[model samples]
Target chain A: MTANDYEIREYLPGDEESIVRCFNDVFTDGDDRFVGRDVESWRWSFTDNPAGWRVYVAVCDGRVVAQCAAQPLRMIVEGAEATFAQGVDSMTHPAHRRGLKRPGLFVNTANAFFDRYGGADRDVVHFGLPIEQAFKMGTTFLKYEVVRTQTVLGLAPVVPPDTWPAEVERLGAFDEQVRWLYDRCSGAFGASAIRDATFLEWRFSRPGATYVRLGVRDEQGILRGLAVYRRTHLVVDDVGCVCEWLVPPEEPEVAELLERGLRRLAHEDGATGLALVVPDWSPWFAWMQERGWRVHPSVYTMCSRHWVRRLTPLWLRNHWWYTLADTDLV
Target chain B: MNGRNEPQQESASAHGYALRSYESGDEAAVLETFNRVFAAIDPTFEPRDLRTWRWLFEGNPSGRRLWLAVTPEGRIVAQCAGIAQRMLIDGEPTFVSQSIDSMADPTFTQGLKRPGAFVRTCLGYWDAYSGSGPDRDAFVWGWPVETAWRIGKSQLKYEVVRTQGLLFATERTFAAGPAPGIDVAEVASFDEDVRELFDRVAPTSRCIAVRDAPQLTWRFLERPGFTYRIATARRAGRLVGLAVFRDGSFEGVPCGALCEWLIDPDVPEAGHALAHWAFACTLEAGRDELVVVLPDSRPWWMLMQSIGFRVRPTKYFPVARYFSKRHHPRWLWDHWYYTLADTDLV
Candidate 1:
């Protein structure tokens, strides 16, 4: 039969079992290169609708063949404004493939949908595809313009008690204040508006993370600075992940305090190094650069779909790197 | 966390509007106003039925609060909402206030043109009550890019996390190509032998796994607000492949989602049969739109293109972290097939 004999359509109510069968047939054995599957993920997919996201299917000749889906792009970027779409799971049944020509049908179908519903007035449709497909499709990679990479700095050797700062008489009081400050500013990234108290109770109180938090206070017991670090054994060796470090934007000696505090922790804990997540434009990065902190190779890219006029200049976009630890789930 | 003193109030005139707590009896008016507003934006927006409204206002255990800006005539022109919750920041205790579902009267759209004014009003409400502490942050989860741009200038910073793309099968180019070698079957029931074939092949598939009975039943048969269809392929009475789809909509666009498609790797031709079957099902159902969630990987894209699925330039940021760092490396799975609007995962 010719390809015209086939047709494409939507998934019906009873298709779940057959769909599962098709999935199992294609991926007969799970790849060991990846982590084990958590059934909860699948459960979540079937339920939970914070935003009204949707999915679609392709059928031909009364049989299920290819499928594609989309969801709302929820994050905000520093500048530029546009609604975004996340394209997920586009695949064809193996038996239906008539060579390289089949995948084009899928792409053509998706593009037609976008052109009809996306509205020409929209600024840009943003999504991440594989680097190879991106090249083939001629879609611009937002990371090239929006992302900033930096070499995260690790902690230095700790100084002895004799070398502690002269005004460090009230370190205990300082720690409390720093902790208090962190409680207030935790959800700046918009994942959740949960306040500091709940965050501390849930994350740090747990044991598996092996995190140690510290505070640098002034003589007046004001919380001027704070940092949270965790011990982790990387592929090569044990290191510290600086989950957080916050100082008042106005602090004059913030850099010196971070240096001394980190050094002391490293030496006391026998840590080989400490990896801190900082905004690309952080002053601590420059300080670390001067102090011989080695810069790693990978840079985390942040992209957003927003319709607002550029308020924060492009130059200031790299001012911060919110660490994974700062999020609620991590 | 100790409650701090309230923040200094900014001049209401500076914002060109007054912000206040939503009143109890304003629910109906607010919902009506929003429905009208969205209808102006897009006629297809589904209004909240009474049951859905009750769920939003009373059924939810999360103590969410709503605020609105009223016109001089007592009409609710603008509205915003917040959910009080806690999140971690740098391993410290933090409280966050999440904002969502801000809407304004279409007639006053010109007055609301100052995006910064609305944002300031919303944030001022938070700071005045919640206080800016280390852990206290304000969040907006799903603001459209245009809306984000209008108000993102002030204290709030915007980061784009996930994007959705759309595809339509307006033309059937696959019909011009050669046909598949295997037989594609459409069965009304998944029998024992079919189940056995599925179980045997599921453990090896990339996107489909053998789900527990509870999950299978709940996701497919038990879920409300969606119509699901399944199609399977068999060779010599042994199940070799299957594909699934859900009848749904996206923001009002009638569509069908290809939720899953799997075939034995040994019998690659089964993949083609599944795609052809799925496409025909979509057409028969009279749905014009189709969507899929694929990872930023190559092999899956190639498979999709080979069978008439077009790529919509979009990406989804599926945030995942290992529950325990010591357990195993984080694995990125490209398993999401097409999804339906009513599906909860989105």
Candidate 2:
């Protein structure tokens, strides 16, 4: 069919089956990572927020040959109100594959639909094409760098925690203190939420995972700092993992607290060393550096697509990883 | 360049119209309203980054559309857009569609004074187009909690779907000491005896099989990100254990990770051999730390601690669903092991 023979139009009321078939045909590979929802979830996107949705279809010889749709972005990151638009279930019927003129026709029609109903200038469009197709389209590939960090604790030859301050051992008693530190620090990275008591219990109190909560208290027994570490079972082997170590950002004795906690883990647990993961930009990095703890590099990439420049600062955008000891997820 | 200028005035007649195409003169006004709405929601967002503005005004054929809700004074209050051929979702038989970059002029929200109205308008656009029946099976991705909460559960149901894990590598160690039970020993290479040991253990283990030289090279040695070390353990001059390690990031920490540690389960000493060899290799490589991604249910935690590996909680979201069923196929996933240098390989 010639370009003139086809009309590009908004999706009408009766186009459901045609669209579904088109979707099935286009997504031939059974990979359903994102669109794996049942029909109910598919319908929910429409019924929930209809006004924010738009679809366009191309018709030729009384049959719909191609279609496209977009919706607003829901995640509000940083300070930008961003919209994410995806090109959905777009396809050309098999019979029309031989027709060379359809692509331009369909493109023009879909663009028109976007202009009329969807505000293009105000939305960010995110689309994926196969590596070959992306190369064919002259799209630029953006690079994201991943960073890793490792922590090493120096073990005292013979000193263990029992010989240290009583407050160091008492730090393991309160779970809330650990949560407070995680929320204040890890929350900034959009890491796992630690507000729920159940989540905290599941993370800290679970079997197999080792880490004892340690706290540094004032003379009044008020909790001022907290750290979590556990020595591997002597029978299991002798390494110790520092699950968490946090001092209030305002705490003046943060260094002392860290030292006290580390010495206790090393001396009491009979550990060879201690390791933890901290964000690259975290104060913990400087803290570890000042204490003369040996640091090593790790490998892992953290990447993100931003609608607006929000949490990704130029410096923090570099590589950073949490040590297995520092994170809640194994 | 299809540019046209028009005053920012909305006609009363245009208030409740269902769906209409954009007129030539509506471009700048639509863009202006969008910037205003976005600014209200996030002041830090630069107005120019919105690709919709450029696509609509600049006339790109990559399938972009902009629809608006016109006020009585001809002002655009709410708007939505559809871009063609964008993202792909995991399992759905549809190209991904996003319902984003929307803003309801707070003046309109306050004048109407009903939060529900803005939601209703947003829902109206989504329902009219994104629904399954007709022209497209587009799925919407990335709806944050605030948007989902505002629309109400009756209208929008939120699911905590899994995506890929974002790992960072850093240069600090968090383990308190050397893990217990791990015999720290050094080995030279994966010779024939070691290969036989690895092959014998492959059939019974859950680890990915690396029987042949090509498979071994491709899966372990060929990757460009990290330096690899091969170690083997022997008892009675017969190979009984093997550990393959690489330098990589765990979370963001610089460390070595035991990507593969296999011991003949039937041979009790094999475990010790493997652990000792691996640790010695890590130390020999001059890595101050190491991490292994273990299954949530694996007994490796004990093994890790025994050999000087500390437990650090890392976050990773690996989402998968079966194409034919509602439940995910559990077998497809591997408990990943990470180290400081490995992060760069991927």
Candidate 3:
């Protein structure tokens, strides 16, 4: 089929079945990032998010061939609440990979998605944590800029530090204390996704995703630190990923206590070690290095396309309290 | 053109402005545009004087470079200036530049498109001064606060050397550690002997400003509307170390800053003695904290951290555009030893 045969348009109500088929066909069968895609998981990401979808598709006579879209995010920009978009599910079927002689179906569909959603009025900026080649193309053709090189800190399993009591327990759901904890922790960032109970409740409730929520409590049984973990063989190795790590930078003792408990859990889950993400500039980076956690280069690079003038490249780079939980990859 | 030998002019129609090199009489116009632009955006900006402007742009002994963007009405709306310094990079003498007074008036550039007049002005400046050439600077850089940095990397090819970290002493008082036998003395001006001290310390860094007598005089001594307490540490009548301090405010908060600190690598005690003196002087000034920036990967970081200081990264990335392999950013990152005085922002 020629590029003229493909029609690029927005996502309709019944596009999930063909979109999943297109995704499975586009991605390698046993790829680490995309082991597989099912209709149920696809719907959970696209339609079930509270912030809604920003999807676009290329249709050739009712057959999906390429798709590009984002899962909307509610973020606080320099203390003022705003909505942001995280670009995801970027795929193109093998048969129509190059578009032969013109701008491809994937490019057309991706442009349609960005044209619909990329702006300050819509989501401030449309960003993604894409691999290197995608980042280069996005920067060259689509006006994307590097935000940060994701830095992941890793340490092998060890006995818990005995200086403080590691009394963390499994939490069933995020509560009011988690919201308060987020409020106290957000001051350390220039910008970040809103980690309130409303967002977390919807974020962690994805289908077929298993996560262990752990929290450390105070004498009054108030949650002081929280960590969301999953022991999986990631792109790197078998490790307990700290999918979400939330605690005040000022309270290193509380962070250590929670970390001690996670190490125990990670060891019990047969994980090789615990891997956590902390920006290289953060005080927590030094804390982790002091505790013998070495920084490993990550495959994902954070990039963004700015539609807002005020949210300049440096403003976003310096301010954002970004973490793995902000992206759909985790 | 004015027909009276005005600065060399080049057509810059991309933003409805003309670009030109600096001439002798352009100081007042440049200063006016700088003060006006900064006053509009930064409330804490202190108005600059013509004498300081003349001394800043014209007084550089190594070299001076300036460019301005002017309207058809002869209004100087934007400027790209560099106060150049001589340095020994990769075993050869070379010139490096630090940008000061990078400005673009909002009134003149309100609705200009992306890669606006200000960004284009900077690009024009870089093309003339940086990259491979016999007379080109090793690299030109600026400690852009935010707007400049944003417009720079997105438009101009700015590669960040590092997101510099600041070390702040928790308490303003001196530690109870034993004082070294080095004799610390306050100096009225940097004498010719200071050059010798800098030469001894130059080998420790790969790309460093040759901080000799001329640079120090223009940097700290001759600067207008500011005073830095310059202290020198001597061992057996030999200059072993130096430190400069200022009582200042940032964002209207009363603060103290250690502007410059350099000690001989072989004489670690001299660094301790200087640090102790800085702490005691700041304590006498009743400051809450003493802030300074140093590469955290350096030996000085461990020395300062041991003196009850904590390091936190600042958003200020000292970005650069290089011309030669001698001043590559990788070499600069690991071996560029600089202090607050090196940048014009402070």
Best lDDT goes to which candidate? 3
Model 1 residue A214 lDDT score: 67
Residues A169-208 of candidate 3 have per-residue lDDT tens digits of 8888787887899888988787788887877877788777
Q: Of 1 and 2, which scores higher on TM-score?
A: 2
Judged by DockQ cut-offs, is candidate 2 incorrect, acceptable, medium or high? incorrect
Ranked by DockQ from best down, the candidates are: 3, 2, 1
Per-residue lDDT of candidate 1, residues B1-346 (tens digit) = 1343434443335434556665567777778887787777766567766555544444433234565666545676577665433333233343333444566665655555555444545655455444435433323333233444435422343333223332333344332121355667665444555446545554443323233233334445444444577677777756777667766654445666667555566676776677666666667778765655443331443455445454332222222111222111112222222223112332
For candidate 1, the C-alpha RMSD (Å) to the true structure equals: 28.8
DockQ of the two-chain complex in candidate 1 = 0.01
Preferred candidate (DockQ higher): 2 or 3: 3
lDDT of 3 by residue, B1-346 (tens): 1111233368757577888777667777778888888898888788988888877877767677787788777778688888877777754666778987888888888888876677767777776666554356778887877667766666776666655666777473234243467898888899888888988888887767778888888899888888889999899999999889888854355667889988888887888888777777777888887778876546786567656665545666687777665554444666777888787755
TM-score of chain B of 1: 0.46
Clashes of 2: 174
Worst 10 residues of 2 chain B by lDDT: B320-329
Leading candidate by DockQ: 3
Residues B266-324 of candidate 2: C-alpha lDDT, one tens digit per residue: 66456655555555556766776555654332344344444444333344322211222
Tens-digit per-residue lDDT, A104-157, candidate 1: 545544544354335324423333222223222322222222322222444433
lDDT of 3: 0.75
